[model samples]
Target: MSDHLVKVSDLQIGFKNEEGELIPAVRGLSFTLGREKLGIVGESGSGKSLTGRALLGVLPPNAVVSASHLSFENTDLLTAPSAELRKLRGLKMGMILQDPKYSLNPIMKVGNQIIEAIQVSNKISKAKAKKAVFDILEAVKIRDVKRVYKQYPHEVSGGMAQRIMIAMMLVRKPDLLIADEPTSALDVTVQESVLDILDNLVDERNMGLIFISHDLNLVSRFCDRVLVMYSGQVVEELVASKLHDAKHPYTRGLINCMPTLNGSLEPLPVLKRDPSWLGAAQIGSGK
Candidate 1:
């Protein structure tokens, strides 16, 4: 066991292409996490989602995964049993998917879903689970828990539904919360509210957070550390507050492309990636 709650080393994911050749999604990726926010920022095709799925042990069947070391606390998640991973996902490690509409069951009562998630993880009584769910809703700044609990998924607003998802995940008080584009589906204001809820939850719970998104600007503001990926490889790693001080060409391009205070877009900077930075040679560790 170490102070790090999650440690991924030399992790790799590949799948057979049409030509029957293996295509790597995430290659030789590595990192460490604890009680802090870690942001994974890259474009759509940069394998960011696959990286999060890998940690959850929920990769698609076509994918092949191998890692030198993938440990959570003292347990090696890469080889842990399905039952063990289930327990972790339930109580100790929770993940927030990109969309609550897809992740949550449409037919089930929203309240029941949250209660079921918490009850299964904690194996608590009905009364206890109900109380935990209500408290979690309040934590996320969702008012009128009684009404929210009675409503179905389709019955609630998108913002409230997202809050329910957050409440469901947080009820267990997980040590690590992996959010994969948690706000991508919401409107601008709802998105901010969701991010605010996440910020408050992470701070109050003292839990580790891994926020995966394409918006470098958002990640820079939300996290303490940033891992900048380009075409499935980490091009640079920097403290979030110092992202503007990044030295890597790819990282710099990302920063320059962000809309500025002046809001001038006469000629936005385009990323000029060095071909050498793409090959396996430079896919080396950011550590």
Candidate 2:
């Protein structure tokens, strides 16, 4: 197996507009992931989520996706057949969507959903799969597995529901996990707990994690390295601990926009955009 779990080069995602002209949403985005946490930070429309979705071939029917190189381990994702992708999706590469409310099935029991996830690639018996679900739910910190198993998505709290979603993905023990703002809706305290659980699991499983979020502060603190994107381009990549020392003006502006605890109480500085930034040279490999 390759040390690089995911390698994306010159990736682009485009959608057809009303006039049938293709407009690129993610342009020339490239990064490599190993068995560590990599954060993608940018504003809502900056193409962060779309990049993650493209990796799993979850883009909408009309989406125009192309890449020079988009490979996961030894598999070439762009050229892989649907059957091959299906075999790898949950078993080798799992994705945790931003919200469990929309992601989880409203009609089914949470435990059943997990069992279904486990059986996506495996031919295990229901009894074995159910036990796996229970064990996985417990691993994600759910105390009453049997109780939560029978409950619907509406029955569980937001935090617990998110944990259940994590458990569903972890049940397969994927090598690469793409989490898209898993804790955005939760309160601050619950958010930290969720992140802690995610981090611990990624480390314990020796899996690569791609954490996508709009919160720069959270990304800097949680990820091993950070990729700062703007207008569909990754302007900078830097070690998370040295985020404050970033070279790109866009990265610096994002860091500056974050409110400081000890600094003066004056109005925060606005981020001034530069059109040339879209065409600027990118910096640093995540390594």
Candidate 3:
């Protein structure tokens, strides 16, 4: 087996405007993932979520996706049949979307939803699936598993809902997990707890994690490597710990723009945009 779990090269995603012109959203993005957490950090609309969605074959119907090479393990995602893609989703690859309110089914009990996910990925009986669901709920630090099992999406707090989402995705024990701002809605303590669960999964299961967020400090502490994206392109890729040593101006600007508690009282530095970055050499070449 190859060392990489996912391979993407020259991936481009766009949508046709009413005028019938292609407006690119993700341009020539290339990267590879192994059994490690890779963080993609950028502002909103920088193509972080789009890249994750594209990998899962979950992009909108109007999306135009083209790539030189896009593969998951040995399967070519770009040409894979819908059935094949469906089978891979939630079984071999799972995504934890940003908002649980929109992601979860409002009418179904949370436990049933997770049980369905487990059974859909595996041909397990409801009894066994329920056991697995409860186990995963506990794994994600949900204190009252039995109570949460019968509750609807709206019943749980934001933190608990996030954990339930994690449980739903992890019950199948996928090889790859894409977490888009998974902890954005949680408190700091809950966020740390969630991160710990992800850390354990990566270590125990050798799962490849794609953590997408705008929290640079959190990413630096939690991920092994970081991809700094700007305007739908990766401007810099470096070790998470060395983010302060970034060479790209855009990356430096992002770091500088972060508010500091004890630093200068003056206004934060504004990021100056450069058109040349769009055509620059791809930093995330996965070399």
* Full candidate order by lDDT, most accurate first: 3, 2, 1
lDDT of 3 by residue, 130-201 (tens): 888889999999999999999999999988998999889988899999999999999999999999999999
Q: In TM-score terms, which candidate is top?
A: 3
lDDT (10s digit) by residue, model 1, range 1-287: 58888888888899999999999888888888888899999888888889888888888999999999998888899888999998787778888887888888899998899988877766788998888888888877778889988888998887778778877887777888999888877777777877887887779888889999888778888899988887777878889988889888778887788778787858888888788878734443333
List the candidate 2 regions with Cα displacement exceeding 4 Å. Answer: none
Segments of candidate 1 deviating more than 4 angstroms: 187-193, 280-287
Off by over 4 Å in 3: none
lDDT of each residue in 109-205, candidate 2, tens digit only: 9989988898887889999999999888887778898899999999999888988998898778888899999878778887887788788878798
Question: Which window of 10 residues has the lowest lDDT sum in candidate 2?
Answer: 278-287
lDDT of each: 0.83, 0.88, 0.92
What local lDDT does model 3 show for residue 179?
99
Q: Give the candidate order by descending TM-score.
A: 3, 2, 1
Error of 3 at 68 (Å): 0.6
Question: Total clashing residue pairs per candidate?
Answer: 0, 0, 0
